[model samples]
Target: MRTALLLAAFLCGPALADRQSFPPVDEADRDPSLVEFRETLLAKIAARDVDTIVALACPDIYLSHGGDGGPEELRANLVLDPQTLSEEYREDADAMREQYWTDLENTLSQPGYFDDEGEFWMPHQWQITLPASLDAHLAYFVTGQNVSLRQQPNRDAPLITRISHEVVILRDHQSSAEYQRVLLTDGTQGYMHSDFLWPMTGHRAAFVKSDAGGWQLCTFVSGD
Candidate 1:
């Protein structure tokens, strides 16, 4: 649990015992320091507080998708000064900032974007690992058929459970294109064929921290 994140419930489940490891993140892998910064950043973002946002950001922030720089670049892009904008540039300027912030705000609401080093490490475009205990908040139903919750990603792995049609399979929010990793209510974690599940609205976050104790948000994105 974290100072800000204590507001949410938590989960505990078994690891997917599959051969093909799911690429999405997991609750077990999170860094509390990163999670705290994420929650605080989200609050500041909702309030549109630029000063506080920059204070928590790394001066040399890395934007993998957009401009590759730090606070200077982020502030330049996000601060939409109407008086400075030319008539023609006004529309695109506002839209660009809007889209950028919107995407980030959306991304930060999900989970499992951080790596072992307490740094954000989502290499893929869209991925989420459901929070360990918050499965009740978002889940997927085993659709149309009885699906085997496998111990591993492959078909040969041992079956953890036989899921029936519309059975609410609590997702760990960890995802891959082919197989989605999930957890049973009984605390058994495993993989479900991605095709057999349906996902709901979920939120996740990202971070950038240096060894010298600089903790801040790099970016945030949300997915299905």
Candidate 2:
């Protein structure tokens, strides 16, 4: 309760006495508590206070491909050191540290990014699914369908694989018609058909206001 008030105070700053409002929702019925919570949480995110960020989470959290289950793990994930990742994934994870946080802060600061349910549509977190010689390359998600992988640049090369889903992607440092290079999550280096992969918005973190009017993260999952 005290923490929530402190956060509200921090955001309100003496600059203005007027209560700030959220992005206007089209729906007439919106929860005031949820709106307030979302505003406070976004404020803390812009400030990059990971500790307070962790405190805003529910006891059980769901951080896809990154972390899960409780505030402690979420804190660890946020402040995770590259050395802490598995030996193979360490290098890539460390390389992405800067961009990841930058995107996160950017997303948090965007208005109307949240829904009626107060789920925040965060920026995509590009991850290294494996340890490969990707150099300083980041991963890209496959956003199209019927994507093909060929053994060589030609259309007649052996069909290595076909991607039939959205958002399932590999780390591709380079692109070409003959060989669309990719690194799988299991350290497999191969070529997929070119032009299927594209970056997409990341999953959402849903926050619910507790009985005390303090907002807390309840769930997280891949979003549209």
Strongest candidate by TM-score: 1
Query: TM-score per candidate, in order?
Result: 0.46, 0.44
Q: Write the per-residue lDDT of candidate 1 for residues 1-224, one digit (tens) a residue.
A: 12111212324333332221222334524566666766788798898888888777776765544546677666765686665678878768878678777756755654444455556643221232444454434555454345788888878889887775332445445555577776654456677788766443323345667677757666532343
Candidate lDDT scores, in order, read: 0.56, 0.50
The reply for model 2, stretches above 4 Å from the true place, is 1-29, 65-67, 106-201
Cα lDDT tens digits for candidate 2, 46-93: 776898888888887776655456888767666778888888888788
lDDT of 1: 0.56
List the pairs of residues colliding in candidate 2. 148-193, 149-192, 149-193, 153-178
Error of 2 at 77 (Å): 1.8
lDDT at 94, model 2: 50
